[model samples]
Target: MRQLYLNQAALSARATTVIRDADNQSRYLLVGKWGLRADVLTVYLIDGSLEAEVKQESLGLLPRFRLLYHRQPVGHVSKTFGVIREVLFVRGLNWVIMGNLNSGRFRIFHGRELIANIAPVSADGQTIALEVDQPDHEALVVCLAAILDRWAKHQQRGLNPLKNRGWAPGLSSEVTPFITQEKNLDRRY
Candidate 1:
């Protein structure tokens, strides 16, 4: 197994994250961008060649992403609503991701075979470690990690801290910040 490390809490618009190998040598670079309707994330090799690209195609309850390797469609990753655990359906590659993705603990499986294992490397949850079964799939794994992190962050943003034991159910977390700002304004008035 090839052990890789991703040193980013989340990928934001205009942020670049580096994926390093076990020896701390940079293996890939993930550059994130804000698209007109969604987010775009691209992966490049250490030498600066485009390895793969992931574009968020939709921003609904079940988000969908398109994956490209060498600018060719490899497949797409789409989240499926589940009450027990997070599940991602990877078309084209016929892979499935199952487990608690928000916690950064999940496994990617291709059919009955295991492809990779992802988990937080630090207690602070700042760094994530990936153990991939093959070296050639490293680039794909990098792209998947970025998308997974992005989706997890998106889920968190929709949560309402004041409801459902810290979950807002139908309300987006964006309102909380605005509500806090309004409270500050009230105090000043």
Candidate 2:
């Protein structure tokens, strides 16, 4: 298995933005410091739309784990401490749900309704299945790619505020705008 490291600098620079209107008057964003832990980890949902709390579990000198999405926290098999390898998002009826690579589970709430849970399935080497209730695969993929691209750019720039390097360091000028435009289109939907 391949090991992943949490880019502390990138994590600290992580920021998510939510806009409500064209004037950008009602925009909300969450930015904070993040860390990784083997025993217990806490992930905070910054936007006003969601709230989360995570706790460590105990099993006879061993540690158990729980990840709480929204208001409910569920238990899962415990594993050794390591960096978060990936972040995943699935589009539901109303919400763009997020999850980590290890857990492989996500929840989406659209308005007051909770959509179906998404899971991965594989039948052969070439066939991969992402079980989603909605069929907007193109929009979903674009949104996820945009988020990941932003993260990658942040990581490549060393996430140093003092130096404040932009994404030009890692991506070609022509490709960057295309990515930004795609993300903007995704947000409109």
Candidate 3:
């Protein structure tokens, strides 16, 4: 049950973003970029170690991403269309990520059991808290949070976030149209 926070924009995920702990100290980084053949994304430690990675399974058909830990497949993340719009596959855990488009809050669940929470995203950054029963899935949960945040940002722009993945420091989004989710859509009675 390690507590962590995300204070960066995922839609800018083409590069990298530094994540920190509750003390505002840098813990790890989330990176989404291009590989030699296709898109590549992963999380790393400050000492430069691989925590988790994303590998595309098929390019022609539905985009499916495998979550790799130390070069081994542990889980996967796939895009889907639905009324509530479910996305992200939590591999071995068999969990799916879904949230209110109107609310910044997103929850991870293993069937009916609540796993983690990502919420209170501000102009500064988004925060993630994990309560998974297994400790090993920490990194995987973080990556899922990034994927969801990036996906949501793209949704506001009327496009697919999977098509453009990159985020980090010292990168101006002007090169690519970047829009961060600011406020929830207000409804009138």
Candidate 4:
């Protein structure tokens, strides 16, 4: 297990486990932070299952991104760049949201590669929304929606199906719905 810290505050004490999918070479993990706070900090691992050769380092970091739920502040999520608008793990893809403030473009990255980009939809001191390209772009969004839904359920009930090793229904179900929806949407166009 590995320890994760945020600003010297212990975020997660146990090392998050990363599971690999043999079919597509994708990696998955579950990460959460426990503390005396009103909100829970959680992140679903969506990519990079590769073992850490070093002692302990974050897989990625994002310098200037904020997470919002329905216009309310959720928490901060990071990527390798600096700050990320969002991070989605679906099937075998890791979708990372990046913004180019100077160009007014919002870009999505799969691993280290650029996958898509769209114009900025909205932004303020606290949050930013980017218009994702539809149909094809729906895959990432749907995956994130599924993750968020499951995460909310887990937080409320104190149970996470993804924590199970052999019969992880949360991960399977969360991914399947998004894939099916995205496929259907793709077939439509």
Candidate 5:
């Protein structure tokens, strides 16, 4: 397994951040661009080549996003409207994310194979630990992790007024927003 660390504080505070390995070696550069409705996160290899990119497609309770690898749409990651657990569907890759995702701690699987594990985010919400099973998937995993971290932070901010209430075609909140059991959970892409 390969261990990696991301500075959550840097990622949230700046436009660009550096991702490091267990030995503190610079592995990739993460750059985020905030958009009116959608945000984009791009990852670049240490040598200055593009690794991957995740772009947001929609907002509200069930956020949607698409992932690009080699500048091609590889798949999409979207939140499911679940009341008990926060579930995300990775369409193209067929990846499953389980465990405490709202807290930034979870295991990722490609079908039946475990591919990566993200340690519970630090108490200060400033660091994230990632253990990936394969070296080739390192960049992709890191990029995905960043999106997860961003969403987690958004959840932490608590947009109750807009999130708690649902807007439907009629004059009623009959369409309730999907609620996760955990309060501190958030996500982005």
Candidate 6:
């Protein structure tokens, strides 16, 4: 099981997530595209090394995401039955991200073990907090959070966020703040 935290949150694909250890020393910088020019998610270690790359594989009911470490396939995070997100780690430490995108609340799990939970820490929905059990897996875990985070937004709206959105270096439309409208779907029992 992994328990960690993602603090100082902001609404940006090119993000910097703070993970405070017992002494508050580690941080994970989410480096990726924030515009339409690129399509990739890279999590770089603080020491200036590529930790993991999350690439979108396909577009469908549940889009598939591939985790590449050292240019090798490590695991796969995909939507299960067009609903919950499942992360199957081939190496070790598999996780599952479950939530309702409508509410924007998600939880990470290692099998049945709860690893982390993500929810809006602020009323504006611009900031979020992720609580995880393992801090060492902050890079991989947070990278997955980024992926699942995108998934939640995608689930909320019928449009694909990646198709019309991206993160650039600087001075881009992505840096400009915007509003997200949530569509209220009709649920029949």
TM-score of each: 0.78, 0.24, 0.66, 0.21, 0.76, 0.61
As for TM-score, the candidate ahead, 4 or 6, is 6
What does candidate 5's lDDT look like per residue over 60-148, in tens digits? 77678888987999889877764435556578988877766566787889888989998755787678888999877777787778777
* lDDT for each candidate structure: 0.80, 0.35, 0.64, 0.34, 0.77, 0.60
Residue 113 lDDT (model 5): 92
* Local lDDT at 42 for model 6: 78
Candidate 6 lDDT over residue span 1-189, tens digit each? 433445424425355554444345565556764323226777676777777777777776656777777567777766666432333332244766666665667776777887777766667776566676665555666667676566566556545454446544353664676445332333331
The candidate, 1 or 6, that scores higher on TM-score is 1
**Model number with the top lDDT:** 1
| Best-fitting candidate, scored by TM-score | 1
In terms of lDDT, the poorest run of 10 residues in model 6 is 83-92
lDDT of 2 by residue, 88-159 (tens): 322222344445433333444446554433332333211112233443332232122223333444455554
Global lDDT of model 6? 0.60
Off by over 4 Å in 4: 1-77, 80-92, 96-98, 111-116, 121-189
TM-score of candidate 4 versus the correct structure, residues matched by position: 0.21
List the lowest-lDDT window of 10 residues for candidate 2: 1-10
lDDT of 5 at 177: 62
Report the error of model 5 at residue 74, Å: 0.6
Which 10-residue span in candidate 1 carries the lowest summed lDDT? Answer: 169-178
* Local accuracy of candidate 3 as per-residue lDDT tens digits, 37-103: 3576788887899988876565532466677887788787767655246555566769877675445
